[model samples]
Target: MNKNLIRRTAIVAAAGAASLVLAACGSSDDTSAGQSTPSAVSSAPAAQGQHNAADVAFAKGMIPHHRQAVEMADLAPTRAESAEAKKLADEIKKAQDPEIQTLSGWLTSWGEQVPAEGAMDHSAHGMAGMMTAEEMDKLKDSSGKAFDTAFMEMMIRHHEGAVAMAKTEKADGAFPDAQTMADAIIISQTAEITRMNSLLGKN
Candidate 1:
């Protein structure tokens, strides 16, 4: 009831209200700052299974290996003397080209890099059944029947390497798609290996 006291009380009430408003704003900012964005877990993991580091490495390694096989298969048409050798080479190209495309596509879908041409050194990896540089050179230099024989032999070894790599993928890789591809390589390459052996004898 004193006039000065009434004014003072009104001033104090305004200051307290302003302090409460500031406290509310500070609390809201603290809540916002404390919140975190969700981690990026892959949604397709259940459908394809969990792809780990091994699956990635397997894809990275195998893509180049398959590409080299395609390169060798391409050479067969030019180098083979025998009709059978040429036919086998043509068949190899047909089967492997689609597979190469499929594997490359899978790598892309998985957000992995497709191995560049000549990026991986076959000699350094020392994959079993890989032709040595000297061996490839010999095949390239040969002509006619010599080329046919060498090509069949070299291709058989190459297919064997593919089969080996596929088996590794099947055993170690997590994705169902990778295992399916591995099964295909096993079936196709086994048949090709047998056919190549017969062709070698005939040549």
Candidate 2:
């Protein structure tokens, strides 16, 4: 064979081998890309998994309950005669407002309805420590020392009802978020109950 022809054939063979190597590498790259795409999609957080029915009920019920407590707190500054009573009311408002917002956000995120802005049926689920409509009406009418006593007593009962609801949530709720919130309510309200008892000289 001619030397030039031999050199040309060798060069063609080298080019063909290089092309095969590149094709193999391209195929490997395509498989890697395909594998990564599904992994990325699978790792995404699911909205449905984050909430359940128990969480929905807890958020819906708590929002209005918190709002009523806040209303009762707002009444304290004007109606309570004692500085201590006013301070307790302020504390209740400060603590509960954030929790209300938190629970409201949960309801919104879960696509659930917020509770109506009206009187709630405290007896609906056997919730204890709730004041009757008459008691609430009396609290609304009174002022000064009478207001202070009424506010404290009513709030103490309200907190107790909240505790009972929280216990129910802890027992039957499936969502971790609702369970965590229930735990917080139990802790905070228990502490408040102790404080209120001391203030009432019942401790």
Give TM-scores for every candidate, taking all chains together and pairing residue i with residue i: 0.70, 0.70
Question: How far is 32's C-alpha from truth in model 1 (Å)?
Answer: 48
Q: What is the lDDT of residue 3 in candidate 2?
A: 98
Give the least accurate 10-residue stretch of model 2, judged by summed lDDT.
121-130
lDDT of 2 at 179: 88
- Kindly report which residue stretches of model 2 are placed more than 4 angstroms away from their true locations once superposed: 1-48, 119-128
Rate residue 175 of model 1 by lDDT. Answer: 82
Instruction: Report lDDT (Cα) of residue 93, candidate 1.
Output: 77
lDDT of each: 0.76, 0.79
Clashing pairs in 2: none
lDDT of the structure predicted as candidate 2? 0.79
lDDT of candidate 1 over 75-185, digit per residue (tens)? 777777888988887887788778778778777887887877766664436866666668867888887998887888888888888898888888888887788878988
Model 1 CA deviation exceeding 4 Å by range: 1-45, 122-124
Best-fitting candidate, scored by lDDT: 2
